[model samples]
Target: MDKDFWLTKWASNRIGFHSTDVNPLLIEYWPALSPKGDEHVLVPLCGKSEDLVWLASKHQKVIGVELSEIAVRAFFAEHFYLPLVTHIDSSHVYYEFDELEIYQGDVFTAPLSGVDLIYDRAALVSIAPSQRYAYAQRLCSLLKPGGRILLITVDYVQDELAGPPFSVDAEQVQQLFPGMKTMLLCRQEADQHHPKIARQNLTRFADEVWLIEA
Candidate 1:
């Protein structure tokens, strides 16, 4: 998958991954990071997520990078925020508001050198396997030394489903971020009652969360 894949997903409103509520898993695990309420946090591939609002409410500053201008605009609009927009570059635009800034462009092009925390709810699993190693590198590159990551991923038999929430098992997570101190925090079977899982026709699905320190 390339930029067009995601851009088209947004354009066509095909985002089954977009959660209208703050993910309960994030609420449960964020405090484990022991945030001091004054650290910059990066939310990658954020697609108008309510979690962005929740993070900013609890943290110092929240930065979100999204590929879709429509998603970014919708994020601000949905939050009732009137952002001061700037044209960062030809490929990117920036939106700034109280304690929140969104970079609208390809995530690889966003200038996230380092942040104190990263909340990777769907960012890693959304990418294809071929790009995962490089994606992990980029994630580490953007986090400070000793920075923390709260990552959530899905694990399932790939042949059973074609996915944006791709199957990223524990072993692959280790291979993806070899330099980090990683720990498995939780692993739960996907809810069969959930519409996405039902639609995917998956009988064996695992939803996992991990904590990583760089």
Candidate 2:
């Protein structure tokens, strides 16, 4: 998938991936990181997610990187946050209000570093497998030493469905992060009643969460 693919998805409101409420898994497992409430958190491919609001409550600063301007604007508007906007460069725009800041542009080129924690709910599974190594490398570059990543991914038979929520199994997750230590925290079968599964006739779907430390 190309950049315009996501831009179009946001513009046309075909955001089946967008969650209206905070993800339950995030709430259940976030505290496992023992956040001191002073770490800088990064959320990549963050599409106007309610998770940003929840992360901000737990961290000193929560930074989100997204490609779609519509999604960024909608995030602030939906949250009733009037952000100070700044043009970072030809490729990026930064929006900030209190502890929340979002960079609207290419996540790979966004000017960011020294993140203590990275949250990847939708990012990893959303990328094409060929580019996931580069994506993971960029994430490592953005993190501080001893930093951690809270990642959530989906697993299913790829031939059964075309995906943005692609199947990224534990073995691939380990390979993507190469030298980093990966710990699987949860593995649960996908709810058969979930709209995507039911509509797509997905016979086997599972969700997994991991903690990766650098």
TM-score for each candidate, following the candidate numbering = 0.95, 0.96
Tens digit per residue, CA lDDT, model 1, 1-214 = 3789998988999987798999999999998888878899999999899999999999879999999999999999987899999997898899999999999988887866679999999999888788888888888888888799999998889889887779899888888888788899999886878765787677688889999988
In terms of TM-score, how similar is model 1 to the real structure? 0.95
Q: Deviation in angstroms for 80 in model 2?
A: 1.5
Error of 2 at 199 (Å): 3.0
Q: Write the per-residue lDDT of candidate 2 for residues 21-40, one digit (tens) a residue.
A: 99999999998777778899
lDDT of 1 at 41: 97
- Give candidate 2's whole-model lDDT: 0.91
- lDDT per prediction? 0.89, 0.91
Give RMSD to native, each candidate: 1.4, 1.2
